[model samples]
Target chain A: MIKVQQEDFDVSAELAALAAGNHGIGGIVSFVGLVRDLVGPDNAEPALRAMTLEHYPAMTEKKLGDIEAQANARWPLEASLIIHRYGRLEPGAQIVLVACAAAHRQDAFDSCNFLMDWLKTEAPFWKLEETEAGEDWVDSRASDDAAAARWQAKPDRAAE
Target chain B: MKILYFAWLRQRIGVAAEEFDLPADVTTIDDLVGYLTAKGPGYAKGFAEPQVIRAAVNYEYVPFDHKLSNNDEVAFFPPVTGG
Candidate 1:
């Protein structure tokens, strides 16, 4: 499942829903992203503040679907879910959530990390952090692409 | 044609989205970028560092050689930085 919405979600409820299925799955891995109080590129702002998120409508869902499909292909996942929020948010507010279930801990952990890595690089979302200095849109970081590439490089090398 | 920009590219270009007519010979991402750079100073400035810009055709990440058609929606963004 993939979602992009303005409303906040219940983390416990989501985890329960994902875990309530058939008992074939033995492990579940989940991740939650939260808005930080400090602003600026590196959280260098003196006064902590809020954030606003923006995203493309059709593109966001399509990209997420692709990422989920990739994860399912790599692992025998019983279930998976990705939820990301849009609109204005404050410090400590949840920004995104990713959950994965598989037969082993390794698959679950890897898939959870993979989902986040791809989402960070490919998802069509932008953040505008407001601080004492004013509002500043965040810049793209090379680290995200590196994270995504780590998994992809193995296959690429094999093909080469 | 619909065009989208993200991350620092959006900030530098000063707009999130724009609509423009597809040029006749712009059959690839590289061609499209060249055409856009000629349109105005803002686009030229935004696309100045061509090597750093990443593109997607209809939400699928594409290389410069990727083919494009009039119906396609193209987006340009910088290297992603999310956790």
Candidate 2:
């Protein structure tokens, strides 16, 4: 499970579905990324009014599927879900959600981190935020690259 | 043919999508980038540093050496930045 949508999702409902199938599973880890009110120039204190997210439609889904496949290969996840939104979103809006269910806490935690890291660095999505200052396009952050690099260097996984 | 730009590529190219005829020798991503560079200053700047740029054809990520054909959708952009 990978979904890219434009509507807000119910995190609790998604977690329930992810957790329902595995009676043996002992842990479920979920991550929800929210749109922040502040982005861009620090001194200017930009108030993000809306965000428009663009993606390579067919390619985006494929890349996300690949990420899930990799996680499945590494861990014993009973189920997983990834939901991402597009179009204009307001501050405090949920942008993405990732949930992992595994037999142990370690697998769930590691898989969730791995998915989020890969998505941040490799997923094809562009964000444009309309702020008080003006419309500012978000840049690929160096920090995100570092986060992804950590997983890319995992001895068990091939280089991405 | 459709030409698509995403992320910083859209910022540099000044548009999300555009259309153009397939040029005679433009059969690879590199050739297309060169052709785009010749279009104007913005294009040249957009592709100023080609090493940092990546491309995809018809929604599949491909290297600069990837071959292309008529009516294909070609995209140019910086490394993906998403989460």
Candidate 3:
């Protein structure tokens, strides 16, 4: 399942939905991303006020579906999900969620990580951060690009 | 054809989208950029840094040299920063 919306979601409820009706699923891995109050990840001061997320509405859902499909193709995933929220959000608010379920814990973990990596770079969403100084669009991080690049090296599954 | 802008590109361009009857000489995404840049100052400023601008034709990302059709809906923005 993939969802793109402006409203906040119940994390527990969403995970339960993904895990339901799958008796074979032995383990599940889920990740949630939240907004930080600091401009830099390592910064101690909280200069950031809010973040407004923008996306191409027509393309956002389709791209997320494509990412989920790619993760399923590469792993033995029984079920997966992606939920992303847009609009202005305050610090500590949830922004995104990704979960993968499989018979093994490793598959669940690996696929969950893989889903987020792809979403960070490939998804058609951008963030504009508001700070005490002013508002500015966030720049793409090189480390994030490198994170997504590493997964391209060894594809676990071949084309059918 | 329709050309859409988002994020700062939309802010700078001063419009979310625009319509154009593409000329025969404008064949690729870059060519379309060249055509629009000739329109006025807002467009010129919006597209001043071509390297940072990302594009999609029909909602799928493509190279600047990707071919275009008169019916295509092209969008321009910046690199994604979503989780």
Report, in order, each candidate's fnat. 0.46, 0.69, 0.81
Candidate 3 per-residue lDDT, tens place, B1-83, comes to 99889998899889998898889999999998898888889899999999899999988999999999999999999899998
Number of the predicted model whose lDDT against the real structure is largest: 3
Candidate 2 residue-wise lDDT, A71-112, digit = tens = 999888889999988888889899999999988888899899
DockQ of each: 0.46, 0.64, 0.87
Quote the B-chain TM-score, candidate 3. Answer: 0.94
Which residue segments of model 3 deviate by more than 4 Å? Answer: A39-46, A157-160
* Tens-place lDDT digits, model 3, residues A25-112: 9999999999977757677555889999999988888889999998998889999999999999999999999999999998899899
In model 2 chain A, where is the ten-residue run with the lowest total lDDT?
A151-160
lDDT of 2 by residue, B1-83 (tens): 89888876777888888988898988899988898999988788889999888898877779999988887988887777566
Deviation (Å) of B68 in candidate 3: 0.4
Q: Best TM-score goes to which candidate?
A: 3
lDDT of 1 by residue, A1-160 (tens): 9888899999999988888956988988999999877646775655647888877668788988999999998877899999999888988999999999988888899889989999998887878878788887778777777888998866522134
Maximum-DockQ candidate: 3
Question: Candidate 1: fnat, from 0 to 1?
Answer: 0.46
What TM-score does prediction 1 earn? 0.86
Itemize residue pairs with steric clashes in candidate 2.
Answer: none
- Best of the two (1, 2) by lDDT: 2
All candidates' chain B TM-scores are: 0.91, 0.93, 0.94
Better of 1 and 2 by DockQ: 2
